[model samples]
Target: MLTSLWQRLRADFAMLLAFLGFAALSFVFLKLASEVLEGETMTLDRWIITGLRSADPTVPIGPSWFETMMLDVTAMGGVWGLTLITLFVTGFLIVARKYATAGFVALSVIGGALLGTGLKALFDRPRPDLVPHLVEVSNASFPSGHAMNSAVVFLTLGALLASTHRSRRVRIYLISVAVGLTLAVGFSRVYLGVHWPSDVVAGWCIGAAWAILCWITARLLQRTHQIEQPGAVPVEEEGGPP
Candidate 1:
């Protein structure tokens, strides 16, 4: 009984820490976003954007290999790329008979996308014209869509999948990959000179916060038995088709 109580206490403490950390992160992101919207980050944005370009100002600074690599990284955050990942993951979950998990993943991505669109419209910030864009872009740029959606999709998917695994190392690896992909996508936006540095920062902040929020909500639902624990074996109905 004592050991069980101790484990419960540890689990509760860890969750409390997570909640607090996420709240702080969201606050910081919102603060940075507010400053960006107020135009306080313009000077810094210009410096970073210009620094990434060649002396000619129009050309990107990196060598061909690096640029080529970044293009691949950036594409992973793009619409079709994210769509494919989402569909594949969701489909796999459904095939495994984890319908609730699949539904939550789908909702999280779609909701995050809508949030990104609304925030872009709300801010209506323009793309960086400080340097030539390495790739074509046509949208408001306060918060990068690529960055936001990548975080939402990758992080949510990672966390959900990680819940199924028992190994601590495996869980860490999953979360790290999700975070790495998010950071890479955000950096690619700035490197391509289509987004200001602040834009990517804001995207990272908001996107991460949204993913955390979704995770917390799912946790609460599980506590209330609204949804089954993620990664648990699917329950077979006695009268249902196998």
Candidate 2:
């Protein structure tokens, strides 16, 4: 099984390349964030101090109802309540050793937390002082943890569920949910005035890279399991199935 998975990965060379590409992209984001977002927590911080006040938001979907609903979901619920709820749930699943699914979920939550915290510490950025902060926060805010965590958890969990099943409909549903939720979370950060547009963008990129790494780790661990098991020898590539 280990050999088979390795063969499979090599057979589709593009997949591995994608992983590297995302990591590189995330590194670039970090560099750019450090250079561009220096001591200028004015816009997002100001908005956070004041309150969410959209002059105009582009309509989502075709109908006004859909657009309105998305605004609320992404801006308020996702950034504040929903994001934390998902993190706790994912952590529980991981602690229970429901790997693959649990790893997928945990990667999103823990990875986001770590990445967000690391970035904050690296830059030592300051929070906004424009408004009265309802929630107590001590970290700097370049890449919003809420945005990053939400993106990873929803997207990777969706991918894991899709992969474990062999149904096309299930895959589509899972992927769609992931995309929608991630977008919602990102939008929420911007809408709720806690993050800048750039912060959200960086969060999305970092979250994606971290999630992919988790997937790769899970795959490698699975391979190790097969190798450690008794009598689970690898078969030679006898031109049977390349």
Candidate 3:
């Protein structure tokens, strides 16, 4: 009985933490949005953008190879790259017979992309023009799509994959990689002069909140057997084991 009670307590604590994280992120995004609209972040944005460049705004303050590497890192957060990743992970989950989890991941990524797009259109903010962009970009950039989508995809995948594991260290490692990738992508946007610092920050906030929301949903669904539990055995077909 004590063991069962401890499990319940842990679950409750996790849910509480998720809710708090979601709320905090949402508040930050909203606050940043208002400040951005008021032009309150323009000075800081310009300063950071210029700080990353040399006297020549076109030249990023880094080795040529480093700039090339940033381009590659930023590409990982692009639509095509993220889509391929989502498909690959989804395929793996389906092959493992975790059909519901696969569907959930697909929907979460798609939904996040749509959400980011809608916000960009709604804000209608212009891209940073203080420095020449190192990469091609054509979009309203209040919240960076690359940063947001990367967070949505990477963090969601990390959380779900971590749940499937039993080792605490493995779970921590997976989550750390996700966060690191998200941060790298966001920073790359600013370094490339394609997005303002505020834009990346806003993206991180909204993306993280959405990921947390999805995680909470997954937990609720798991409780009702609507989705496969972590480490659940594959269900056999009527005919028997394959």
Candidate 4:
């Protein structure tokens, strides 16, 4: 009884800390974004975007090979790519008899994408034109859609997969890959001259907050028996002769 109580207390404390951390991050990012939208951060935004370009405004700061690599990296965060990945994972979960988990994954990614779209429309910030864009883009850029969606999908997916495993190292590896992908995609946007640094920052903040909230909600549901724990071990029956 004592052990179980201690475990529950530890879990609750962890969740509380996560909530506070993400909340603080979201506040800071939104504050920065508000300043940017108010034109208070225009000079800083322009400086960072332009800094990624060569002396010749048309050329990107990096060599030809680097540009190609960034474009490839950016594509991983694109809508079609993320959608495909989500669908594939959802299908896999269904096949594995984890229906609730499948629904959660679908809801998390689709909801985050919709939220990103709504936020973009609300802010209606224009794409940076100070430097030539290596890739074509047409949307308001207050918060980077690619950056936000990638963070949401990757982090949420990472957390879900990590939960199924019992190994600490495996969990760390999954989360590190998710973080790495999110950062790479965000940086690729800046390097390709499609988004301001502040946009990516805002995206990361909002996405992380959203992912963490979803995780907390899922845990609550599991505790309340609203959903079966995806990582719960199945009980085996005693055989007649073994």
Candidate 5:
């Protein structure tokens, strides 16, 4: 068992290395760190420009709509919503899926969410100041919390749903829906002027990396444990064999 545990940890390390490698490719947006910040500033500037240049009174969904949407999303991405989502996911995993798998899913999401929060806090980026504020917030704003949380939760849950099915189409559908939601929420941040493009992109990259790391770690651990199927272990005779 000790040997197996070491092997599991080693395997997990290797898998994590591989995940980082892949993430390096899929999440190359890190190179754009400065550029991303610049773009965000520009995007926020656009919001201000649009407001200043607003010549039509008929456009209801202009700056005001965007502001409302951003604040609303911020609220939706709050701890309450996150807690509810977590509970629902954990319950589903416990009831419908294997406990180990469920544990992995929950851990990955929570870890990813925390990571996003950390990044936001460390960066200490401010939201766009180009437009008049509709609602007030007091957190660093680079990546949108809603985008990060949605990405983690949706992708993790979708992966779980996909893994249970043998049908490729079903898997694709689940993945598609997950991707769609992730994109929608991320895009909404930009559209609403609450986050810069770079912020959302970074959120996506980090969130994805966190999820992949969790999955690979879980897989490696499972391999180490080497679970046996029901009755696969031979039963010893009670009174016959010495």
Candidate 6:
């Protein structure tokens, strides 16, 4: 009884933390959006965007190799790259017979993408004209698709994969990598003059909130056995009778 009570308490605490995180991120995103609509962020956005460029403003302020590296990093957050990653991860999960988890990952990524698209359309903000774009782009750009989608895909994958591990170090490593990738991608968008800094911040806020919401839902499903529990070992792997 004591052990069961402790487990319940831990679960409750985790859920509470998730809710708080989601709320905080959502609030930030909303506030940022309002400021953006009022054109309050434009000055700072232009300053940051132009600062990343050379005096000419057409070229980024970096060595050729550095610009190349940024392009490579930004590509990771592009639609085709994210799609391939999601499909590969989902395929791995299915092959492991974790069908529920696979489906959950697929749905979460797809839903987040669609939500991002709708938000972009709603905002209908234009790309930065402060500097010549280092990368070709054609879309509404209030919230960067690269930043938002990268956050969703990377963070969701990190959380899901971390749940399957028992080591605290491993979990931290996975989440840190996810965050690093997300941040790098966001920064690349700005450095390349393809998005305003505010757009990247807004994307991070909403994407993180969405990912947290999905995590909360996943925890609820796990509690109900609608999905596999964290660190659950397959019976076959445990040498149980087939």
Which regions in candidate 4 have their CA more than 4 angstroms from the true location? Answer: 233-242
- In the range 107-172, model 4's lDDT, one tens digit per residue, is 888899999999999999989888888899999997999999999999888877666566889989
| Cα distance off (Å), candidate 6, residue 233 | 2.8
Displacement of residue 199 (Cα, Å) in model 1 is 0.5
Which is the leading candidate under lDDT? 3
Between candidates 1 and 4, the one scoring higher on TM-score is 1
Give the lDDT ranking, best first.
Answer: 3, 6, 4, 1, 5, 2
Model 3, span 2-118: residue lDDT tens: 999999899899999999999999999999999999999999999999999999989999899999999999999999989999999999999989999999999999999999999
The estimated TM-scores of all candidates read: 0.92, 0.62, 0.97, 0.92, 0.69, 0.95
Q: In candidate 4, which residue pairs get closer than 3 Å at backbone N, Cα or C atoms, i.e. clash?
A: none
Question: How would you encode candidate 5's per-residue C-alpha lDDT over 30-58 as one tens digit per residue?
Answer: 66456655554565546543553245423
Where does candidate 6 clash, by residue pair? none
C-alpha lDDT of residue 30 in model 1: 86
Q: Output candidate 4 Cα RMSD.
A: 2.6
Measured over all alpha carbons after superposition, the RMSD of each candidate to the real structure, in angstroms, is 2.2, 8.6, 1.4, 2.6, 7.9, 1.9
> What TM-score does candidate 5 reach?
0.69
Q: What TM-score does structure 1 among the candidates reach?
A: 0.92
User: What is the per-residue lDDT of model 6 for residues 76-136, given as tens digits with 9 covering 90 to 100?
Assistant: 9999999999999899887777789889999999999999999999999999887888889
Give, for candidate 2, the lowest lDDT window spanning 10 residues. 226-235
lDDT tens string, model 1, 187-222?
Answer: 999998888888888888888888877877777776
Assess the local accuracy of residue 83 in candidate 1 as a C-alpha lDDT between 0 and 100: 97
